[model samples]
Target: MDGTLTINGPKHTDGLTVERQEKPFHPIEHVDARLISLLDMAADSICLIDDHSRILLFNKASETLFGYSAEDVIGQRVDILMPQKYAEHHDGWIARYLETGEHSIIGIGREVQGQHKDGTTFPFDLSVGVAETENGKQFIGVMRDLRARKEDEQRLRSLQTELNQMTRINAMDEMGATVAHELNQPLTAIILYLQAVERKVSKLADRGPITSEDVEQLSDLCGRAIQEAQRSSSLLQRIRSIIEKKEPERTTCDLVEIIRKAHKLSLVGFSATDVFIDLSAPDDLPPVSVDPVQIEQIFLNLLRNAFQAMREVEQKAIKISLKIVTDEEDRRDRLQVRFQDTGSGIPDSHRKNLFKAFDSERRNGMGLGLAIARSIAQNHGGSLDLAPFDEAQPGACFLLTLPIASSPSDESEPKTESSESMDGSQ
Candidate 1:
């Protein structure tokens, strides 16, 4: 609220003298006694000054804050309460405001240093306001001490640093094991293919002439071996990027391609032959603004979660669909990505803490996946949620919504992407 207080009552003759003077002193007449009482009883410091910046009135709280009695401060220049450097600029600051009617701090409050009579400076929050009086214009300042609040903020920062350190250590432990598990699949496949080549070579040495059939088989084995090697290399590179701690680099990219890559990565150690994963999206969808690596990490978490859920079931299936949610009035439409898994739906007991870190009953992980995924989504001005599971269908559905990137032209390539399906063969 502004400094000027309006109280309806008859004025009192008893008022302080701090106006036009033989020596910068003039009498303030017709001041209300109730107004004087209110200022004296205020919890925060209050000081009023005239056009010359000379103190017209000093409340009791101001006396306590500055270690100066009302008698010692009234009629003194307001600059005396601040440091010498600030005091030098005080006259000019007020002159500019009075001349141009432009405000620096008059209408806005800010933190500033206030010097006590003992020659020590302390931080205080100050807000100034101006009012027109019958005699002239007066400026009122309200200030609050900031020492206790500053100390509390410092303590909170320390605690947060400690908590972050511990979380990183714990996450590293879990992530290391996951990397080994995923790498084992491609590495093992590569080894098996190489061993088969060795056997084929040994057999060829015994046989005299090599047939075209023999060359085709060897070529096929080598190609498969190369594919497995490439898989291992790609997995390592992506995981390495994820492990490095750095500021997120946000950019616009194709969301569908990111989802496709993450789906391929998530199946690294899972039984892909027995499982059916359908990823359906529109051919022409606008790009989304996101930190590509972080967004990929989110999709990986969600896909792996679905994979883990269907591990024990004979009929396993995962369906992921992406679409645009058009709400023109909102001025920004969002991309909706939904993942559904056909397995034993989440138990009633585990639903409450599903997204909480280190709290999952069915996962081999420490349960940081969904929690981290949600955090990343929110940081990108998006959201991830577990939609209600249909008991009849017996599956869990996760919905992630992200904002589409803003383009120069309103024209979009086309369409939302859902209700359509791609076979697991891809």
Candidate 2:
């Protein structure tokens, strides 16, 4: 009876009793530390929660992303890491998933907002998975920050917008040149016919018994027609100059004379006759080496803008002042021209984009006057800017600055002459 019992495979042993015993079974832990450690080493944040939505496992990446330690979040409700609104309804969603097993966010990746320990929310990519364990069902979520990707997308959109704007500007330039060419032909013909009619009427009056009043009225009408035709032609010339790609012809000329001619020409319309112009410049000022026509055009634009701005004002005046500016070393470096108008000052909202193409505050404005004027100024080694408004003066002021030519021979290269042919009678 004291001898040990022995059992053989499918056989009985003589002179011994045999017995078989079964070993007890133990269930594995719901979370394996080794597996969690592997997930912790990943770049994306990994988190695990139990059936009750309590955080069961938090990896190193998760700790860093949520700005919390594992000890702070373990056994805590998983909703603490989500936005308040999402947290409030997250439990119901989990319950629905467990009851119906219908896929909503489970087993799918999507974009969502993640809340950090500091309570700041940021965009993230979230992918969730469900697992069944001896302890019950659990959820595993992987989160990746989207801040960098979003910034890249924003930059791309900005570049696309800039490209679109440049394309529009190029198209406008082409259209403007074509329109100017088409208009110049009809304008030239109109002027020629009007001139011929004036001559015929004069000859008829001399041979017939035409009354003095009739002759005077007819002459006045003919003169006004001719003037209007010339004005139209000049406007076309200005449009052509603005869209012209060739270098302008530069010559030595007096800036004062240019200003006077611009002042006179800008007054041709009824809207500008009531506006008085005051000019000031030093008599000993040196001649500027520039395109006289281009300079006059700049003055004309400035004066026209001033007149338009002052149309409703009781006091209508434009003050033009010129001075030679010297550098720090006392060497003559620039010429400064200031045009100040007694009119309604530019609004603060309009100041920033004042020189941008196609941006204007006037109802009948083309929005190119200031843009082209500034461009011409910059092309001539100069700048045009709205001067600071004087509180006492109560008007708008513009300053034009140009670099003085170093020498008389500092000229632009000669450009090829281009001309258009049009029949005046047609």
TM-score of each: 0.57, 0.41
**Candidate 1: pairs in clash:** 19-26, 21-25
| Model 1, runs deviating above 4 Å | 1-227, 312-315, 326-331, 347-353, 358-367, 388-393, 407-426
- In the range 112-139, model 1's lDDT, one tens digit per residue, is 8889999999899999999997656789
Positional deviation of residue 242's Cα in model 1 after best superposition, in angstroms: 1.8
For model 2, the stretches where C-alpha displacement exceeds 4 angstroms are 1-245, 268-270, 328-332, 358-367, 406-426
| Tens-place lDDT digits, model 2, residues 1-426 | 534344231112233322322112222346577787798789999888876677877889989889999989887888889898777457666655665587689878899888999999988999999899766778889888898999998896566445434533553464565555555765776677677767768887787877787667677767766776776776656545544544468887888877866665555343465666777775555577788767777887787677777878998877777776764655756888888888888878777888776785642362566776787688687789988768988778899987665433432443232222211111
Residue 110 miss distance in model 1 (angstroms): 11
RMSD of 1: 10.2
